[model samples]
Target: METNSKETLQADFDVFDISEEFGFLLEEPLTHLPDHYQVWLDLANNLIHLIESRKLRDLVDKMPVLSPDLLSDHRELRLAHLALGFISMGYVWQEGQHAPAEILPKALALPFWLVSRRLGLPPILTYADSVLANWKLKDPTGDMRIGNMDLIFSFPGGDTCRGFFIVSLLVEMAASPGIMGALEVMRAIKVSDLTGIKNGLIKVTQSLKKMKEKFKFMHNHVEPAAFHGKLRIFVSGWRDNPMLPRGVMYEGVSDEPILLSGGSAAQSSAIQCFDALLCIQHEEETGAFLTRMRDYMPPAHRQLIETLSVCPPLRDFILSCSNSDLCQAYNSCVSALVDLRNYHLNTVTKYVIIPGNHAQSVGCPFRGVGTALNTTGTGGSNLMVFLKSVRNTTQKALILERLS
Candidate 1:
């Protein structure tokens, strides 16, 4: 193996502290910061209440602009980011999308920007903050299943809001083994071990299947009405959002407005990691958007995907080997990913497009929230077109000749 590939094999699978048994999820997220930062925890814990009572803005406006320098531990910084991300999202969308706040006060924006700098994440709520580092086990010794989990911070959609974030967390957890499997495939490819490669691909396929199963729990816990009307805005970002056309001013951070995408599943690293490993090619537009979403991911997870993209070519090796079983295993991994994407398409149709059409037909009152509903995603892409294009590109990754 080349020096770089050997190093990649050792480093990419488990990003120390970043990758735990739950893949990108922190092993045990800190539910509270130290007493000094209790102001943030107090605001975050009572966020739904504050937003509902129309007092979140008043409280945030009066709170002190604490320094991120006070937080030194990695886990503490992550907790700070999580709490701040939730509070900021709530603050911006407190009046709902129609009358959204345009400028985040210095008290909230400064600490969040600094915490984001310390963590190498953007100054907004992301899948990293909301899903990856946001959950805790109800019972300390319990498995990380949805039933055993609850969110550390949440939006105002009641159980549906809790369900949305936790289910997303479980999906990431389900992908943990596959992440390890992809690394194994990389190692096996470095050694030209065909049997090893085949086994690794099998693990990846199994993990994708588990991810799809976990995704189904979305329906059981989240109602489309509550998700679209109540929970969606809190996760919506500044860029491409009709509500925040000028984007948000981060008070003391920048003179010009800063634009960012919302807390998106596209920001999750697991699927993108699989895409890198399988060498699945997307069209220019779809691929560009996926690439952009990487900016919203935790830096370490983003680095893992970057490493996987440059690793030894697994798809080419599978073709050169001319082994039907090997081809079958590789194709199974691709097929499983394709199946997961298809299920995602169906879920979006139910959760986003369907509710959007209903809202439009009935002349919904919350125009700002409903503006991008069927047309655009929380990440600001053309909803159906982007997803379909991605799914199609993943389908093209199937090695047809090798199958025969």
Candidate 2:
């Protein structure tokens, strides 16, 4: 979708939606930056190019900032330093070159940074601190207490978290070898192979379990009391069949029982139980559902409904083979879903289309929907644009009729 105007762009940037807009702005060389920053800009561009080209060996050797010493520095330097480290390590990994035993420390640090803090690293640390502090204040002896009160604790700590981190690290390590190789590596790493690795894994799993229990408690207790009488809707999809079970239709039912067997019925039964729907397969189903929903939903609900309908493609490839029948079917479904969603969106006077999961692909029209949502988690931005368009069109029509 085209930006409404530069005014809208500025307003969007005023909030944190600039990241969403960043995806759009990246389509063109940023004319907004001053000429003086060209060196830094060029450096950043070259860094990305080298990383992408798998030619990081020469680049990393020359860059002191990417050295293992910098990577092991305090938390503040970790993110920037680790990103550079990953580019170097990724390059080495791509070339089928394992780091020397001495250099493996640096290689391990790269994935540790990626798993612990790459995306939202600083914020996660801050949040973890806040959570631990709150827990300590409430229950000093609780199991939720942060063991390393001074050192930044990984949020969602425990064995499962560790396992996930390990798996992610291994996966990134084996990305060049592809998924099967990654899985093989995961299987090869026995619990006894590394000291404290089992304990770390256990902590991750326990922490995850605790997190789930806490969420379940909060959701059951807090959410019902807070959002009582409101219709809650949960929408998700199944892109990979292997990720799901065999013999299951793509666009049919959810595997989760709360959502699958009784979610819709529960919503229908109780004033408190919210309506939920999941589009498991083709994007087209989401579009069709939104179009059908428009006739029944109020203006307030229409925005979120529209947003869900217009979500971008949720998966990269249906399978490894691009030319496979599954890929074709998946693409066709996504295309149809997007078209239907847009058609329904055009029918509305004020609506929002928030994107989820697959927010990258510009080919999908709904990618812009993520931008339109801004950061408020509210439909105001979209509603404002839609309402303005409708009002302008109405005024134009009245003027034309008068002239006629």
Candidate 3:
């Protein structure tokens, strides 16, 4: 019965179909995705079963996909191969048995070369050189990059992406005898405990620092800075209730360009030294702004503003924010961002917001008001529901962007 059930589950999810266009796009010489996709899926499934069965030998056998010798021959195919390996390795580390004696050392050694190259180290550096080269070419403007040959990918969006990387890295570390000792120390502390969490984080930080130092000697050569100059940030606001608070500023530097909505004011602020502009609000004050701009602006300018104003995703995001709960706050935020991105609100720019504490957790603080607003049971928290919705949307957007 168990075998039958496993077979049924695999059959249901494993029969993936690749369209001709998708095949062409993914299998193109630069990407060669099709060549690795099926192999990855098979390996991923096998790894899942191996973890369940605690079959270390089987998992070890699967590691050859990321073997330096094999990967060195197909340098251009590194990303596709690495992505698969990292994903599979992460799965094993997260779910498999704690057997450092068998696999920890291998995992620790795997990414040394990869991470070094990503930091822009020497060409003679092991597998790291190829790993960085692959991601540097994949989508430089985007946040997706393979972290290690174990097939782990990192997205630079928010905590969720950070969490994913941490988990994957932890898994790799857990495979190392010394790193496993550090993890054992971590495992003893309760992450929910305030003091324990702090201590645990300190230990993890120290381990990372040590790892960095160990690889420092290999990185005398420096690459050009990946991010240079001022970044442009566009802020879209609702007329009546803008989500961004009054004192909020971009987190990084002072010189970044900020675009704000000017809903009611007729006078345009001087753009000379201003890094950001608040565009006029689109909701309640839309009428006044429209009238003023119509009277004062040329036809071309009006057309441009009109195009900027009609963002369906932004509108949906505002609605979700207005109705969020604890259970779904994170998800709602994810959904809102995804919606905005998918609708192409600010396609040319990348944006990140420090989600307030209210939207950070899983419950709605406004129980009475939420209930009054027709939120009941799990749905009682509008914010929570919205967050969940947003997360799903973001996941879809990421996958779509990858496929596209």
Rank ordering of all candidates by TM-score, starting from the highest: 1, 3, 2
What is the TM-score of candidate 1? Answer: 0.95
Cα-based RMSD of the predictions, in order?
Answer: 2.6, 26.5, 26.2
- As for model 2, its CA RMSD to the true structure in angstroms is 26.5
Best by lDDT: 1
* Deviation (Å) of 329 in candidate 2: 22
Worst 10 residues of 1 by lDDT: 11-20
lDDT of 1 by residue, 3-99 (tens): 9865765565446334537688876889877788899999999999999898999999999988878787989999999999999998999988678
Off by over 4 Å in 2: 1-13, 16-86, 97-335, 338-404
lDDT of each: 0.87, 0.25, 0.27
How does candidate 2 score on lDDT?
A: 0.25
lDDT of 2 by residue, 1-404 (tens): 23653454445333311122121111111212234323222333354345335555554444332222323323323333323323322332333212211122233333333433433231112111111111111243443222311111121122322222222222122211211211121222332222222222232223223322322222222222111111111010111111111221211122321111101100110000001111223224332432432322222223333332343322222222233433333333333323322333442212222322223234323211232122212111133343333233322221111110
- Candidates ranked by lDDT, best first? 1, 3, 2
Query: Each candidate: how many clashes?
Result: 0, 10, 48
Better of 2 and 3 by TM-score: 3
